[model samples]
Target: MKAENLAKILKNYTSGWVSISKNYKKVIASGRTLRVLLQKLEKMGNPDGYLMRAAKDYSGYVGV
Candidate 1:
């Protein structure tokens, strides 16, 4: 997916799991935990797409 599009879709999410469309053009679902997210997906007939995490604020996050 393009960085520009990804940033826009993820802007509202500070922390949680997000289900994005396969073409990366839309948000299918989101949840504070994986389990909740999966349950939501199941209810949606488990649409084909990608599962991702919207992490905590990274403005001050340090990673290796």
Candidate 2:
């Protein structure tokens, strides 16, 4: 896809991560969020590596 389209998709993915993070914060207490985040990280192929790393870290902290 074009760079602009990729950027837009990444933006949406970031938003989804934010929402998922919020839910993980509220519901996961055993690192499940961390695991899920790590899984997402593994699936990441975008240039926004930092965001994915942040999400992974956050989820790791929550044990989810």
Candidate 3:
């Protein structure tokens, strides 16, 4: 997925970590931190095109 699209998906979550699928149609995982979310996703065995982002603020957009 394009970085722009990834950023757009991330915008939906105000805080915490988010895991998005390749098609950007589903959420694979979510958590309070990148490490926690990564560990959770890892258990599912490295998803392709999956993207992770840490949202630190709710007032504006943030990137991974």
Candidate 4:
């Protein structure tokens, strides 16, 4: 898979909460690449968690 294609997929996935449903789970379980990416993202934290908060703050320049 190309970077552009992967980016497009991820962009689409991140567009809404419903995107993380069973279909997405099936996609992640379909192969190693997504599993590894999911692991890395987990290590970085996720799902309304700290890393997401930090990302929001960083992007919004709330406390630069």
RMSD of 1: 4.0
- Candidate 1 residue 14 Cα shift, in angstroms, is 1.0
For each candidate in turn, give its C-alpha RMSD to the true structure in angstroms: 4.0, 12.9, 4.1, 12.6
Which residue runs of candidate 1 sit more than 4 Å off their true CA positions? 1-4, 56-64
Off by over 4 Å in 3: 1-12, 54-64
Model number with the top TM-score: 1
Decoy 3 TM-score against native = 0.58
Pairs in steric clash, model 1: none
Which numbered prediction scores highest in lDDT against the true structure? 1
Alpha-carbon lDDT, every model: 0.78, 0.31, 0.67, 0.29
lDDT tens per residue, model 3, 1-64: 3544444556567667777776777677887888888888889897865555556443464444
41 Cα displacement, candidate 1 (Å): 0.5
lDDT of 2 at 32: 31
Clashing residue pairs for model 3: none
TM-score result, candidate 4: 0.24
Each model's TM-score?
0.77, 0.23, 0.58, 0.24
Candidate 2, residue 10: the lDDT equals: 30
Order the candidate numbers by TM-score, best to worst: 1, 3, 4, 2
lDDT of 1 by residue, 1-64 (tens): 2333466676788888989897777889999998999999999999998887786554543322
Candidate order (lDDT): 1, 3, 2, 4
